[model samples]
Target: MSAPADATASRVPAGPMARFFRRLGEGRDNSLGLLAILIVLVVVLSFVSPYFLTATNLLNIGRGIAIVGIVAVGETIVIIAGGFDLSVGSVMAASGMIAGFLVTHGAPLPAAFAAALAVGALVGFINGAIISYARINPLIATLATLAIIRGLGYVISGGRELVISDEAFLTFGVGQVFGVPYIVILLVATFAVFAWLMPRTLFGRYAYAIGSSAKAAQRAGVPVSRWRIVYYVTCGLLSALAGLVFVARTGNAQPSAALGIELDVITAVILGGTSLTGGRGRLWGTFIGLLLLGVVNNGLILVGVPAFWQQVVKGTILLVAVLYDELRRNRVEEA
Candidate 1:
């Protein structure tokens, strides 16, 4: 009997270990697989280009990805909530133009910055209102807004770029903290905040609920429409922030800047494992996805891949990611 008790006691410890391994496997299924892919890409690129592993080159790539990474956070949130915002690129243009134009015209930096954020909020409000109240489809609404907002940017800047000479403003783009670029710091902070928010907040839970089933969420006392509006507004705010950062980094705001960036942002988010149909994803995954794209772009240039082929490679990746997501979704449904 004592021997039997000893065996049972040993099995008790094994049970916890088994549970731990099971949870680890689940996390791997969700994100660790993507992490593994990123590591593989990094190793391959390091072998393909001597400069790819250099600190300077790595820092440059981080700075290059900063803007897109910031926007990707917003895109990830919108996707998680089952909405789309094709106008983000346009919003970046318009918001940057507003801030740059203001500062060039002697507006205080604070006021100009505030104005840019306000512009983003206003646009987001309109997007949310139209979708929530007018019942317009998000795709159609944002697509129309994309053109309208781009046009507005041109009108505001008279089809010219706005140059800002403020030293303080320039610092936002170029400054470093503890050897890390400010833009990279911003990207990391944004990711950190959202990562915490998504997994630990009531807002996140409600957003996921709405995305999974709006009617069901409503029945469960979630204000689906309101939360959706919040999501769109949040997306708009981040897009504006990205615009401001872009302007600071480049020292000018072109009315046509950020063209086609939406595609990149969307691709990164989707590739990070966010379901396009909504209701599942982690910000950490999105962060890795952003890094993967950044590394790929940097690696291609370092390897002497022609500019034209770069686009082709990116397009192929996007297509593959989308197909994979669709097939995965189908399997889940069938199961």
Candidate 2:
């Protein structure tokens, strides 16, 4: 009887908790786990701050993170392709200044937008070309361009803010539909498009392949150089688009706009589980990361934390996320 009972127990499937832990050990719970963390954070913050769950504040959070979320989408793409763009913040300033300069000079709204996008695309192309063809390190390449682009922005804006009064142009920034902010809508749409693009398109597969192993991708006829350029250029264009939204939201294009935004974008991307080493991430993860940051920022302010301390918290979070990512990478390699 004892022998028969032992055989029957051995044949039983694993329980729910066992399966859950097994999946987690296999590293399959990344995004889902992050989402769970985000939910807990939201619930806790809501309880700690009465204003947190208010509709007004909720909408405000959406508006606040709109630009960061938008630029982060591009950063996600670039990082996934095993590159970085430290110049996105600078590019945002330059692009916005270009559009504001044009609008103030009587350029039509469409023309102004076109010029700004062109500037962004041109800068992106340069960054891509240097990295892909000249074989420059992405960090050094984008950092150099960061300074150059920022200087250009200062020169173009004459070291001052370019304020625009064009209602038509401003509408893009301030407009809303069905009581929802246009900027928020734009952010959601951008994420939706890329979310589709990444999993459903060959371009996404090529990006993953390149990030996994550029040499292997090259051998597989993945056009590593071309795709790299495409990723950087797309990053540039998206950063520029975010700049336009920034200008709209703020009603001015200051040369200093989006300063340090790259840090926030990169931090969000990494926190969202997009590997800093590349090739393993999801767009939705980035979105959740953005929301997490936004919630923390808002919660801190609502709970009366000083502004400077918020920076400290953000920096600490970024460091921890990076360290965890490195450890996870090591574990994956060892496995």
Candidate 3:
């Protein structure tokens, strides 16, 4: 009897829940936690605001977040590879103004569009070059670019808004397929492309490796500088694309557009599980975070919350996200 009892005790195995929790602690299932919170929010909001679950309101939320959501994808890639981009908002303003100015001056729509994109890519390249090649810290370098780009935007606009009257271009903002706005489709398409590419491609692997330890990745033969520039360029292109989208939606280019938007993108990315220190996060997490923020904002509006209060809430959420990332990072280092 004693021998049988010992065998049974020794054979006892860890259950599925325990394994799940272990993986969660290791940070592999962060999206799962975020997903649960999203679902709970949906449930609560559906009850709190009678309009929250309506199709029109939901679509409005999608449209509201599409710009930030699109930008966040590129930002996610940058962050994962141990980089930062504070110039996204400024780039958007500048790019939109560039396109608007050109087209309004009788430049063909295609040419103006291409010009905007090229300018954005150039700005990104410069930022990447300054940081990666010139060895300036990313925070300081991108901050400088942010100021420079915003200044460029104002200079181009001459402190006046560019009124866009092109119907073809404006359609991109309001056009819909199957009752879904084209902008929303764009957001989804971006998410899908990145989600597939990030995990299954060499670029993705290199990004993670670089973020995990740039010195180690360099020793392992990764072209660290080249890839860093490429990532920033991609971010720039995406930022320009977002600017075009903004121009279409608003039918005008204001130098002030997208001001302070970078902070919002950073907030969404961090909330989605991307670490400020880099090397850990997912696009899906960012997507969920985007929706969560959108829904929360929409809910607050329905509940008649003040605009200033919304800013305060957003700031608090960002702080919490940073704290969580710091705590998790510390725990990982200890482990």
* Ranking according to TM-score, highest score first: 2, 3, 1
lDDT of 3 by residue, 260-297 (tens): 89878998999999999888889999999898889888
Clash counts for the predictions, in order = 0, 0, 0
Pairs in clash, predicted candidate 2: none
TM-score on alpha carbons, each prediction: 0.92, 0.95, 0.94
Model 1 agreement with the true structure over 1-335: per-residue lDDT tens digits:
99999999777755765765664454434456677788999999888887888989989999999999999998888889888899999989999998998899899999999999998888988998899899999999999999999997788668988778999999999999888999999999999998899979977887788778888999999888888889999999999999999999999999899999987898899888888999887788888888888988998898889999999998988898799778778867876
Number of clashes in model 2?
Answer: 0
- Flag regions of model 3 displaced more than 4 Å: 1-27
**Superposition error at 20 for model 3 (Å):** 4.9
Q: After superposition, how far is residue 88 of candidate 2 from its true place, in Å?
A: 0.3
True-vs-predicted CA distance for residue 129, candidate 1, Å? 0.9
For candidate 2, give the lDDT. Answer: 0.91
Residue 134 in candidate 3, Cα distance off native in Å? 1.0
